[model samples]
Target: MAPKAQTPSKGSKKAVTKTSKGSTAGKTEKKHKRRRKETYSIYIYKVLKQVHPDTGISSKAMSIMNSFVNDIFERIAAEASRLSHYN
Candidate 1:
């Protein structure tokens, strides 16, 4: 034979506890820090050196190259964002 299930008596009341938003018992939202990305200029310079060991770039020229690469990256990122937003 199966055991009979026990029910709460009519005279007894169950207590219901609610946690507030500020309570630690509730889920906490954590703010994650974004990681810093390394610049591509160093790798670009390395590749250039490998391709031509005798070739050298002036600081001003390197700065121009870095800015050009950054500009292209920004444009590509913007286009990707637009495409993703539309899709």
Candidate 2:
């Protein structure tokens, strides 16, 4: 046979307390805001389509080409800035 459980009397009060472990208080997280990058405009795509009516380029190819061109320009600009003060 199981013993009966005891219940607290109505005259007594129960208290609940929570304790912090102090782990996150000393450390602060730094949030970095990303800068919006400039990209090729829709007008350029319209002009490209007008220039080559039957071009067999897919959207995926265009995306790859766009990123490659952007990377090249960024590198060239960096090199130019680095060499600007040399001569």
| Leading candidate by TM-score | 1
Query: Any idea what lDDT model 1 has?
Result: 0.72
Q: For candidate 1, lDDT tens digit of each residue in 6-82?
A: 34332233322223433654467654789997666687789899999889888888888888899999999999999
Report every candidate's CA lDDT: 0.72, 0.62
Instruction: Supply every candidate's count of residue pairs whose N, Cα or C atoms clash at under 3 angstroms.
Output: 0, 0
For all predictions, the C-alpha RMSD in Å is 19.4, 15.6
What lDDT tens digits, residue by residue, belong to model 2 across residues 5-72? Answer: 33333222232111132334335544468998666645447667899876556678677777877889
CA lDDT, candidate 2, residue 17: 17
> TM-score for each prediction?
0.52, 0.43
Evaluated against the true structure, the overall lDDT of model 2 is 0.62
